[model samples]
Target: MPKCMIDGKEVEFTAGENLVKVAKRAGVEIPVFCYHPGLSVVAQCRMCYVEVEKMPKLQTACSTMATEGMVVKTNSENVKKGRAGTMEFLLLNHPLDCPICDKAGECDLQDNSYGYGSAYMRGSEERRTYVDVNMGPVIQKNMNRCIHCTRCIRFGDEIAGIHEMVAIKRGNDIDITTIDGKTLQTEYAGNYSDICPTGSLTLKDFRFKKRAWMLKKTTTVCEGCSKGCNMEIQHEGDVIYRCVPLENLDVNRYWMCDEGRFNYQHTQDPTRIIEPKVKAEGGWKTISWEDGILGIKEEIDGQKPTFLVGSDLTQEELTHIKEYIALQHPGATIQHFGTPGLTSTQQDGALDQILRMKSKTSNLNGAEKLGIAPLMNDTIKADTVVVMSAGRAKLPKINAKRVIAVGVYLEGDASQFDMILPGLAFSEKDGTIVNHQGIEQKLKRAVLPRGKCKSLSEVLMLLTNKKARVGANP
Candidate 1:
């Protein structure tokens, strides 16, 4: 461990930890543009300048190592002046287009300039211009807004193992571009949006939708696969604006896959079922929650119950459902259903606090916690089957006299069920979902569950007399 003074406060940090990391640990955030933890340090942006005792000049805090008895001043006038100078230089090439730029609210350059630079520009000459380059299908590049941070280039070459971007030319003509005019084709390509200090790299789907400040962020886990990537879903009211990676060092670091970032549109699609429907004589009709519960109870009381658990349900829901089922029918056979062996190799190496099973669905650990194992490679036969399909179109067919489908979406598979119970979607309810690594992440209600749709716990309470309400602590 190396002890150093950051912003006049003495603190100890792990050996080899950069000054920026040490400063952040000591509650001082050094404004950075080119620094990334997972990628190689280029020290190009020069925004994280700090004054150190006995040093001739200010140093880049990101690349400087914390040493024992080192005295660093981050907020002193000298350091502030150097940062202000750097901000001014960075803005020299940047266009004053915050109003129309997609990265307006969340732009680091805009924020840093307001914090450390002059309100007015000193340059009277026309700003330099460059042609916009098509970086990739997932990323668009406007080199004019770029500060030449090289975070994107470093990320492609180091983290993603793809050298798709590079700095070309020299001096005023220094620009980031691809070789042979090829697009940046990488699986983890969406991260450039986060690394971009300005509006240089913007998401095609989220651009111009809403300002960053206008969107509410909900911390949740990615359900794309078993690699439970910690995610923050940003939305306005019921509409999801975008999905960004929440920094969890043990989980998906500061990166998430492009699929995880863009797959949220399906959650708000019109095809989702928003209300409970019962298969009555008049086809499938929307039923009240009270009537729906009673109908399920009536059916369960007369036959052996089979609970079908989906991998998508959170661990908490899995716990409550499994416990309630055991208290109601101790001998009930619970079957786990999900797209098995459907692992994708686009691993984000981010450790999700949520325990990820070999099966990627969110509820596997919850089922295991309740002393119930997921259905293995064995066929299940039951008189009454409780099928919980989070979004899948079909479930493995087991010999069952009656099928009960509980989910938020309507598909052809639910049609086979005698009773269809609509459940809350990800945005509709408040719950905790564990990621692949067993990190329990909480998701608050972003939108009201449409119609009379209820959560899995609510539906279980109705099916049986067992108390099904879960506490917030879990």
Candidate 2:
């Protein structure tokens, strides 16, 4: 391996590794705006200017490739002056609304300005501003905060494969907007907010919500689909505010679709049933956990119930359910169901060239791996049916009169079920799920179980007249 000198430290380089990457390896910070690791290197920001030993002029570290015996000075006086000048120009038009901006704590522009910018302002003219256009439901556009970093434009072009965002004019008057001021068209539009250095682009779903630093982060995988894209659930006071993509080169890389990004809403939905309920003559009535367990046991006492297990459940939950059934009702018919028309892994393929999969549930592969058969024609023919899901899998058509649903359910779902045993959402429990690619990943608990919701293991134990054990590994 070849080595290069960066800020008086010798760092090994991988042939094509650039200065910014190499400098990072040596614990030296090289500030950048337009250089995202997943996106193309354009050096349009020129904020990473560094003094190369033999170079006549300062070079942008993002575009400069490191060679053997090459020396670079990242903290030189000339480098500091150059970076300060770049910061001055960037902050010239940027608004001083950091206190109200959603990107206040996490904005790269704010951090760079504080670290490398001049204390005094040079421009006396009125700051430039634009009449911000609506970017769509996923993103809020504020063209005034933009520093022409072009990260959002490049992301739409190179990563999302959509050339919707573009720069219309040249230089200082350049406007980064959709073609003809149109709304964003891609399904992965939330990522434009993620890669933007400034608050020029922000998530509409997360706007005016909790500040970035106030939210506690929990690293979890997306249950939106079988892609199992890694992400972080940001919550404060046990209330989830947003979901952002976590970098995992093997899975979703640096991006997640909008469906997955906003998927956390269902868990905290006001209409979601959080208490155990039993159907009476007039309507549904909330019941205690003990009564709910007794009701389930009495409902399936002598009947051979068909278990329609949802592929959205974790591998641990599925295994526990299978074991519980084998011990209690040995001959009960068990089947797995997820996306309609897509039963087996063979039918599960890429929905697009990007992260989405044909299987809408995260654990479709795990359910199949547990030796469970797919439900035929999306129909259950037994006299009694037990439908279990984590709310991601689509509900199947039931031919049975006696229906007991276990897991997250909405108020409208009450008509379809005779009894509902409230269970944890994916965010409220920690367990493993397998993607369509057979890669198993863990879903970390981000919040406590809603209301009287219990794990499937605990519910199953109570059904068998055994003491419920919480957090027991399958």
Candidate 3:
């Protein structure tokens, strides 16, 4: 085991690991602005200074490697002075509008200034300001507050594989903007606001909606694609404000595509069929929970049934659905449906070199693991079809005279269904989903189900033949 001394403490670290990582392991803090572990290190901000025992000058912790027996002083007076100076320069042009800023509570600039900077005013010149430009639909830019860290630029090149962000001028007069103010062109563009150290970049979807500290944070996994990027759902009183990527080194790393970041909105949509409905002459008519339960049972009891489970469902839900069908409808066939074109794990490949996956559903691999075959058009022998999903999986066209729809669905999507039973969305259920790499991750319940929505087990229990089935037989 290789070791290094950071802040007078001996710490074991991997060979070639940087000082910032080593110091963090040793419980020593090295302030940084431009360094992201996922992106290449540029060390432009120069905020993470540490005094090496034999070195003449302070070294940037983010760029310096901890060699064997190397001694570093992160808390030395010299290192403290260097950091204070760096903070002063970075804050000289920064607008002191934290009260109005969306990133106020979680802003790194504010935290570093309070912990490692001088309080007294050192400059008398007018503060720098710029007319903010639109980055895209997902990001809002406040260039007046940028510290020129160039993290967004590096993230675009190294991680996103796109070079949309760039710095125009050098030094103090520099401006970070896109080419000719064009809109962002990447599907993973939501990550720019996540990587920016300052309030210079923030989510346009989340801006001014709620303060950072006001929201309750729930750690969850994204279902936007097969990537299953870990994320945190921030909300106030069960109203989700935004979704930010949680670091999972083997999964989505520190980035999530824009599709997953905004996927929560569909769950809270006003047009979603959140309650039980029975089809009528013109359209769907809202029905009671007991009636909806009995309606589904009456419609499919005498017919040959095929259960079409969405691949987007978690493994727990899928298992429950499978067992219920096997026990109640003994000979019912169960087939999985997801992205229309992507049926099996073999067809599920990377949509791009980055995080975008060809399989739009999160649990496609999980379905394959469970030996569920993909739904094919020619295999439709059942008179009644039961389509179940968490609202993300696309429905396969079925030629059945009777179709029972369950799970989340938009009004237009359930127009032709014989019966609709409102079910929980991904955000409202607790279960497990396996990613494209076969890594199983948990999906935590972030918010309670809206209206009459119920869990899969509860919904399926209605078809049982005993007293356990919906209060003793309809």
The TM-score leader among the candidates is 2
| Cα error of candidate 3 at position 243, Å | 0.9
Best by lDDT: 2
Over the stretch 31-126, how does candidate 3's per-residue lDDT look in tens digits? 999998998888889899999989999899999998999999998899999999999898889888899988899998999999999997699899
Off by over 4 Å in 2: 408-411, 466-474
C-alpha TM-scores of all predictions: 0.86, 0.97, 0.96
The global C-alpha lDDT for each of the candidates, from Candidate 1 onward, is 0.74, 0.89, 0.85
Q: Model 2: per-residue lDDT, tens digit, 366-386?
A: 999999999978776778889
Evaluated against the true structure, the overall lDDT of model 1 is: 0.74
Candidate 2's displacement at residue 111, Å, is 0.4
Flag clash pairs in model 3. Answer: none
Q: Candidates sorted by TM-score, descending order?
A: 2, 3, 1
